[model samples]
Target: MTEFRAFHNTDPPQLLKLWHAAGLGRGAAECLSIDAFEVLIFSQPYFDPNGLIVAVEDGEAVGFVLAGFGPNEEESALDYSIGIICAVIVHPNFRRRGIGRELVLRAEEYLKSKGAMNITAGPSGLLSPYLVGLYGGTRPSGFLLSDPLAAPFFESIGYDATRSIRIYQRDLLGPKPPIKFHLVNLRRKMQLMISDDYQAPNWWWLTRLGRLETLHFELVPKTGEGAVASATVIGLDLYIPKWEERVIGLTDVFVKENERSKGYGQSLLLEIARRLQDELITKLEWHVEESNTVASHVALAVGYYQIDTGIVYQLVSR
Candidate 1:
């Protein structure tokens, strides 16, 4: 008989074991470490232990799920409570037995209990912030498209593939692509500034109203020579830490509509890449909406290559 229960203090070791046994080690390397579990999942103040659960068969944990909400204050603004299925791992030995489905259903039930109007089988704990670490970022959002089982599995379990994302990556140790430019003196025309505050452009998931320091960039538009700044944020690039490799994961990049198509986005990325490269933090990565061809054009020009794809799945109560 298989039995399910809430999270316990002693569940870390078994959870980590099951994570690896489920072959999640590739995308979710952080979960392979007990310490990471403490930082990534348990460290979040928003984490709900009651929302964490496990399934056991013959006295062994075969499956587990972690669920929780975004900051409570943002609920009203969203018009619906958004909850995340931080993760769901089922041991390979137990596949085809429907354990994965049971674990997800249970997590959804708990999320609904906490006033969650909709649920995402995406990154949890750290709230809506994606790519904060190796957890949510390993793919794009919901699950890796390469996983084969991911798309169909979530669909069979009542989750809708709400959106698609394209992931990009490049190795700094490899050939560095030349910073090509079509706009004349683009570097002199715009000044790049870096700061951390809520006003910074970042991943949409970062709407939590707290003092979380977000590393962001802003490109000030300059019109004339004497430093008479237009004070317009023409474009920018932003990132968060991925401590394991000391890599700065690109979270967002944007250029004002009128400022776009002039090869400005690529130039902005070049600036961001140079700053990071100068600090020996050469590696950078990020994702864009699958339909965003304009963004993809600049990313490719700046040496970023297509790496993986992930989907965002959602289920609404009504």
Candidate 2:
């Protein structure tokens, strides 16, 4: 017999055990420690004990679901209008017994009770409240297609795929990437600045990326006072134990509004790649929404190739 209950203080070890047994996918961190969960999940200021539902069988944990909400429009507070099911994992031996469905159903009820007008499965961009570095490669990029169980499991539970995010990767050891003439000229007039301990500009950014080992890069005019473009890369150290390769994931890429189409974005990306290659990092990944053609073009211009797709889902009747 199995029973469901809210998360308890002593449940991290059990949840970590279930995480290993569930086969979350390549994007998921392997060999995770309790400390990682402490920093990435439990320590978040917005963590709600009731939002994380766990399943117990014979007093052993078998599955869990983590649900939360994104920031409000002002990016200053939680927005209960859009609730997110950030993660759902079930132990392999305990699956096929409706445990996953029950967990999701309970998660839905919890979200609705909290005033959610919309419910989305898997976290992405501003919709993400946690699991930024634990699950997704770069940032929370919805449920990755590489996870064989995600699509079928969510669809069977009445969710429909409503958006797709393309995961792109570039080999740092490969031949030189294509460089446009405008980018070359842009580089001459701009200086590339790199920092390993840069500060977040706002509360929202600090909440999402504050705990990770991030590499920040910016492109600024040689004589200007501010950056025209910037990009952030996070060390995927958890992956190193499993993949045995030095890897970093790109996220929070930005270009000033007035700087768009001036080639600063591509220039900053190429410079970042060059610097990482020199540091012997083997791979870099960037996730872009399918609708963002401009970002896709920038990524492709830097020799990135599509490696996978992440799907974001919602209830059919919602």
For residues 1-318, what per-residue lDDT tens digits would candidate 1 score against the true structure? Answer: 899999888888998787666655234544246865666567655556778889998878888987766554534333227777767778888888988888898988887786877678765223453224444342235577755566788888778887777777766767988744453377877877776543532322433312233466666666533221111111111112213454555654666766657766777677777777776664666677777887787778789998677777887443
What are the models' TM-scores? 0.76, 0.96
Q: Residue 175 CA error for candidate 1 (Å)?
A: 3.7
lDDT (10s digit) by residue, model 2, range 1-318: 889999999999999988878887788888989999999899998999999999998999999999999897778889898999999999998889999999999999999999998999999988989898888788878899888999999999899999999999998888777657888888889898888879877677788788888978988889977999998899888888766898899988999998899778788888898888888899999999999999999889889999889999997763
The per-model lDDT (C-alpha) reads 0.63, 0.89
| Residue 151, candidate 2: C-alpha displacement in angstroms | 0.5
Count of clashes, each model: 0, 0
**Candidate 1: where is the Cα deviation over 4 Å?**
30-32, 71-80, 124-131, 138-140, 195-214, 221-246, 316-318
Against the true structure, candidate 2 has what lDDT? 0.89
RMSD of each: 5.5, 1.4
User: Largest TM-score belongs to which candidate?
Assistant: 2
